[model samples]
Target: MFCYKFPCGEFQTLTKMTETGITFDPPVYEQRYCAAIQILEDSRWSNQIKKVVEFGCAEMRFFQLMRRIEKIENIVLVDIDEPLLRKNSTSVDPLVSDYIRRREGPLSVQILQGSVADSSEELRDTDAVIALELIEHVYDDVLSKIPSNIFGFMQPKLVVFSTPNSDYNVIFTRFNPLLPNGFRHDDHKFEWTREEFKSWCLGIVEKYPNYMFSLMGVGNPPKDLESVGHVSQIALFVRKDFLEMQLENPLVTTPNLDDESTPYKLIHSVDYPFYVDTRTEKEKLWTEVQIELQRFKKMANLSENELDSYQETYKVPIGLILDRLHHVGATKEALLELLQENNLKIDDECVIIEDCDEESEGSDLYELSERLSQDVILTDQEHEEECWDLNQES
Candidate 1:
């Protein structure tokens, strides 16, 4: 076994060797990283993300990026290949070490050799779970079990999943004419079309209603082929129950470190089990929204006699905005700024309300509802139909 320590006290250990030493490379799929980062940056719960477990942390390319994010405090890297895990655990990558030193608090790094099909108790209570470019490698039987284990058993607040878009293989074949008919890599069991991927995710939601998902593409599809697919498709799943509970009590306990019977073996110990809390920046904005809603009745133009009559009427639009604030991954600050901007514009207008017609009121409410749907929920109906075109061609 080999062990290495970084300047920041982060320790890594390698317990296995391959016939040929593993080599680390920078990630070739830059778009996937960009998508993942955008999800994290846009999240209202960004400050709540601290512990992340990566299912297939090959070469630690994406892992390096996760470590650099200011909120992440603990990371568990898992891979099916023991030798590859060993190589990455002991790697002297400058980017990895630099991220460790720059972290604001103690950072724990755990490396494990395992398959996603197998459940690990250590993974429970994590904030965010990630599996990038990994689902394609698993057979369908095994792939079907992953969501249940990750969402139902581990129950992380957020899950970032990505898989290759088989519809985009033609673009790849242009560079490698001799590429196999249906596979990109020798080990890839299947590359799913966008529809198949959506079906699989929808099934997960059906089984686990506590979770909700949004899908996006990583790379740019050709203008003509835009309907077909992008290079990769990603799904971000959020657990609604956890989101509500986290806002009330942000501190969560780490897994029991004393339980040495865990499948994961630690090479270096940074710290044992302890409690950590999400950053309060976003939560503060949520509180501000709550407080501001109470004051809305006072700000709107209403006479002493009219205040009671219009109070509930004025709440309809504000309620729509508040509902959006609850569901959107956008930061509280951004949502608050948007509300303030729209309020300023409304203040500039001179309006005299003679009567509140129920029909007109409903129409106005529907407009706010439509805007919320467009902004908070992400769906590409065109891409879904285009991705299905590959099935017809086959």
Candidate 2:
């Protein structure tokens, strides 16, 4: 998701130039997207792809574009930036919700906040992995590890990666004289020529003998130059072992979540069932409840006065308050019991749980339960312990 940003003055100048009909055309950006779709279309295994993971899914612009393809049931967007991840997650939630509500195929979207260089358990069992215009931003050491992580560790059936063609810098330098050396972006650590890209692909193929790759270029080069010297280069890797295994045991399936054999931690997830409208009032209430749960967890406790203050500040309707609490992991039975213990009438639809005794010393049972229910750390720890145990045994 990381990308170069021009300084304020330079950006303003660029903007002014563009507004005056002098555009800085980056053909590689659009061409890469087209190439990725075309590659998927050409693949014999395209229909078999139930899930696709996108590395460096900045702003999820490509995800929004690609999710329309009917064959993909799930898309996992991974990025290193948490704020961008959260923003994209918020942006896509309503779209996903609408898709689910309309029954337009089961399409699940997960926003993972993690590094692509690291082998993620969440990447396991996916059909394909995509990284477009991403590799040039990282140093050689990290770039070398990405292929192994994708092909050897995740072991997806297919991988589609694209990077800038350094050879095209000569053409680029013509457009902007300031970039004399022809670095596409200020943040790019290294851009590869066609031969360099091919060598790296060959190295990956050699490292994982079971996987093979194909190279292609996007965008048109000068009539004198070959297609390999185009604006962008793409590599698609297919796992031979996986294809053979699939043919042998066609009905065999991998777990959707991490299991004994696939011991990778599910670090972050946002799963939406194809029935809920996330824009509903109920959903808003649930969101508020979740926020309150986090705040209480951070403080480790909430005094009755603070609780009263929160209740007053955020005036949730009485009729749907209980239902909202239940939606956010508070058990209906426990809520009913709480009502009874306080000598309250459960049938009274107008009743809100606002009466907090000022003398009460402990966190509310509902808040405690909600906080405990979010066992993300515990789940990850258990996975790590299990992986360690398996390693020891091996």
Clashes of each: 0, 0
TM values, all candidates: 0.55, 0.55
Model 1 agreement with the true structure over 1-394: per-residue lDDT tens digits: 0111112231122122134421112122655665676666545677788888888887766655565566677788888887776665654133322432234565677777777866677677787888989998888777877876686667788788999888877765655552464587888888889899989888987877777777876565544556766667888887765445333223234433223223655432243223344747555554445334333433454455664455433432444445545643545356647556445222222211122343674344334344444533333432453334223322
Q: What is the per-residue lDDT of model 2 for residues 75-94, given as tens digits with 9 covering 90 to 100?
A: 88887777777665665554
C-alpha RMSD of each candidate structure in angstroms: 18.7, 16.5
The collision pairs in model 2 are none
Count clashing pairs, candidate 2: 0
Per-residue error for 95 in candidate 2, Å, reads 3.2
Q: Any runs in candidate 2 off by more than 4 Å, and if so which?
A: 1-26, 96-104, 178-182, 226-228, 241-394
Residue 354, model 1: lDDT of: 28
Per-residue lDDT value at 350 in model 2 = 38
- lDDT, model 1: 0.60
